[model samples]
Target: MSRHILPPKAGHPDVICAAVGWDRPLQTYYAQVCFRTDDEPDEGEALIWRGTEPGELPTPEAAIAVITPYAEIPPRLAEQLLADMTATIGEKDGRHQAEVKRRLFGSIH
Candidate 1:
């Protein structure tokens, strides 16, 4: 799971975007997106999309298509969110790989 805080915009003051991918069999993944606003603390999360496959959430167009049913998101901001998700996934995957390597080969000096 990874989260990125969207800066306060003209109308929306507090928005947060999060993406989480679960590993599936055969090296596939299921990804989901969540949106939250600080103003509505008790409203709970707004689920943007739950992808059937791993590839759906990485691109802006695909993500926008998925999120459109729930909430309206600007193209530019959607693109930015996609970029952040990509970076976050990369970081998480890298860390997991390193951990696996360390466990198998012992600590590398």
Candidate 2:
């Protein structure tokens, strides 16, 4: 599994983290939004939302795109997610970049 931990957004204080990753055995990607209160440190994070019904997303970037709305990640973070994906996959493949941008932004600007 390849996991990227995204920090909470200021506007959404309850959100603690957003995790996006790939499941190699399942050959798919997944994303989860988690929350945790200061008092609940021992209890661990709680799941707020999850995306990409098993085996749905083919790439890590797609998983990021699917989770961005619910996680409310900033555009800069989203760009970083793309960059991380590029690093993992190696090289900035135009096809993947275009597809991820289209999915995340509704258009490749």
Candidate 3:
């Protein structure tokens, strides 16, 4: 399982944090948006949305699509999250590893 903890954004003060990642064993992507509790800011976190259904989100992109509406993160941050999630999966897939290397080093003639 690969998890990324998104930094808190100023625009969304009530949002404590957002977690997005992939579960290798389940072969599913998941996301969780957490909010600060009303009574206690530091006490605990409230889950506003969660996408953990097996087979629901087959790809990291699909998970991001479902999470976008709720998370409300900046475009750059969202892109970074997607890249991070994909990298996690790439580590497990040989094809993806080669693709990553190509992107990083270009085609070696």
Go through the candidates in order and give each one's C-alpha lDDT: 0.42, 0.60, 0.61
Range of the 10 consecutive residues with the lowest summed lDDT in candidate 2: 84-93
TM-score for candidate 1, residues paired by index: 0.36
Assess every candidate by TM-score.
Answer: 0.36, 0.51, 0.56
TM-score of 3: 0.56
Per-residue C-alpha lDDT of model 1 across residues 1-109, encoded as one tens digit per residue: 4332222234442334434332321122233344455655544365554544334344545544543433444547555555555555433335665576467556321
Can you write out model 2's per-residue Cα lDDT over 84-103, one digit (the tens) per residue?
54554532326776687577
Best by lDDT: 3
Q: In model 3, which residue pairs have backbone atoms overlapping below 3 Å?
A: none
Off by over 4 Å in 2: 37-44, 49-54, 70-109
Better of 1 and 3 by lDDT: 3
Q: Per-residue lDDT tens digits of candidate 3, residues 1-109?
A: 7777665655777777777776653456777777778676864374644444445566667666655655655556557645655665544435764575467546311
Ranking by lDDT: 3, 2, 1
